[model samples]
Target: MTETSPRPLRVLAAMSGGVDSAVAAARAAEAGHDVTGVHLALSANPQSFRTGARGCCTVEDSRDARRAADVIGIPFYVWDLAERFREDVVEDFVAEYEAGRTPNPCLRCNEKIKFAALLDKALALGFDAVCTGHYAKVVTLPDGSRELHRASDTAKDQSYVLGVLDERQLAHAMFPLGDTLTTKDEIRAEAERRGLAVAKKPDSHDICFIADGDTQGFLAARLGRAEGDIVDEAGNRLGGHDGAYGFTIGQRKGLRIGHPAPDGKPRYVLDISPVDNTVTVGPAEALDVTALTAIRPRWCGRAPEGPGTYTAQLRAHGGETEVTAALEGDELRVAFTEPVRGVAPGQAIVLYDGTRVVGSATIATTTRRDRTTAPTA
Candidate 1:
């Protein structure tokens, strides 16, 4: 349904116990929807996940959500989806890294946990829509189909991470905070006016599961220490690393190489192969890629019938780059208008037609402009 429609809807607000979420739920309720606040318990062992201002899905978060619901005069409940979250988001994260790829767990969480599992349950329980605090818009066309778009506030737009949502999910999704052009400070001010206790709660950052914000440490604990060699582009060993999974494409620091490069330039991580446990480093120029092959494309609406010029966002906070993309037998082949650096396999490649989200896919392989293969030896 259109956001402007006066008809009351049964909206399931997925409150994360943060200021934005609380404000979103309040706005949905104020809009005359039958809103019920629900906080997802993502971890079975609350202590395993982080707490306080820097983390989410903790016991404190649940209490804060409940308090916000109380202030909003709505019913609140906590759903335990720890098993689902672990199997889908957490396990997949480790598996992807083990395969020498970097995965975005937040995108995976929206795809698998929040939209897939939670939305299924919400729909089955007779909810009309599942709402969240994500800064993205759902534009309902006259034809009754929905299109996901970037928020009016470009700085807070979260449509990139939400690119995984398919049409069905988009049809039943609501982002109440999207259309607001106001700054985040205004949202907190609104929250304070509404009497939400989480008005001043700090926004969660980094990988929430990694409580200490130490992703390498967390992966080492899971995959264990497997000492590996860090080599240069020509197959010369530059240094040693505890694990190849600890590095990512385009990473420049903490490589621990003893000697400077021949040109006295800094080296960047160019490749990671879990099979051989090798981290390949090279000059920054070698990292430039012109094309990519992506798999498992999830279209927000219908898949594009032919090659189309679009803008692609490689990382969550990265700027968009122009690209010509085509789909062939489930594989999306994208040619960048200009070479891009820091793109890694398993990262979600989100395509957009201006402000509208077109689709997303997992980057499988990259084609460098030089077409020179890394040294196998």
Candidate 2:
């Protein structure tokens, strides 16, 4: 019997027209893979217009990605996934807001579009893997199974956003940036060495769909404005607002309440009741959240053998706090070791065991365990 050598892998690099993705595609090709660079046109007008040297997903970004592909000597193409993006990300964001929730659109995009839709299509075309520039390490356990870990560059680690990928998607994932311990500056330097035009391009921040950073205006434009009441925890009307969905938990600005608190203390948004069209405001102490119930829990690899404890992060960049989390039917009941603040529903709660990502879910409700503390204001 004749033994044949392993064939070169066919990798489809999803370039976002950034230096990180450009270098990722280059590295994949450099590693003897049959690499192809594909740019995902996420919106209709993807022109990179910079307010002050920061932009993303623009037309120039696409061209920059093509130029990088040209320099890397790989075939490149643009795939129009705008409609899918709107259905999967933008609409989901509006719906979440309509339901009085603060949603993370990036996490949804990674879960539904990149790893799910893009990966499914890539595999249909016989591609071995989908490559990207995300800064999160993917490790193969000694048992021959894969696991996701935080990047060596903690400051730029993107494991929080990548937490949505399940074991199936992780099997076909290739993050070239994850393998590096270097800073983003070093990645750009490598791009410069490789003659990639996006070497000096500014990294895009904020929501890509909202060209203007006015999330309130953006939501109002879609959901429309309606008169609502701003009430205190006791359900006493304090002020009137144009819309209730425009406000978020922990927001202290734009309350526009003419009457000051009886104690002359500032208050923060404690909750949003979309059903009643009321925005609940309370003192700062009321914002302490000690327990949160998250639903739709997804494990990166396997479900915890028997949930005891884990560290939970409420935001993409927020610090992880020790918590006791356990699966209860379809939901996750998490009890923080101390207390956290600003936890809003529909936002993801990424769970980690040390540096390795374990699971994540969308926050459904919050329980303020410190409510016993008297209102000092």
Please name the candidate that would achieve the greatest lDDT relative to the true structure. Answer: 1
Q: Candidate 1's residue-wise lDDT over 157-237, tens digit each?
A: 999999999999998899998999999889989999999888889999888788777999999999999999999878999
Candidate 1 Cα lDDT to native: 0.91
RMSD of each: 2.5, 3.4
Q: lDDT of each prediction vs. the true structure?
A: 0.91, 0.85
Q: Write the per-residue lDDT of candidate 2 for residues 144-251, one digit (tens) a residue.
A: 577888887888889999998888888788887776878778898999999988899888788888877889989999999888999998999999998888999999
Candidate 2 RMSD to the real structure: 3.4
Candidate 1: residue pairs that collide: none
TM-scores of all models?
Answer: 0.97, 0.94
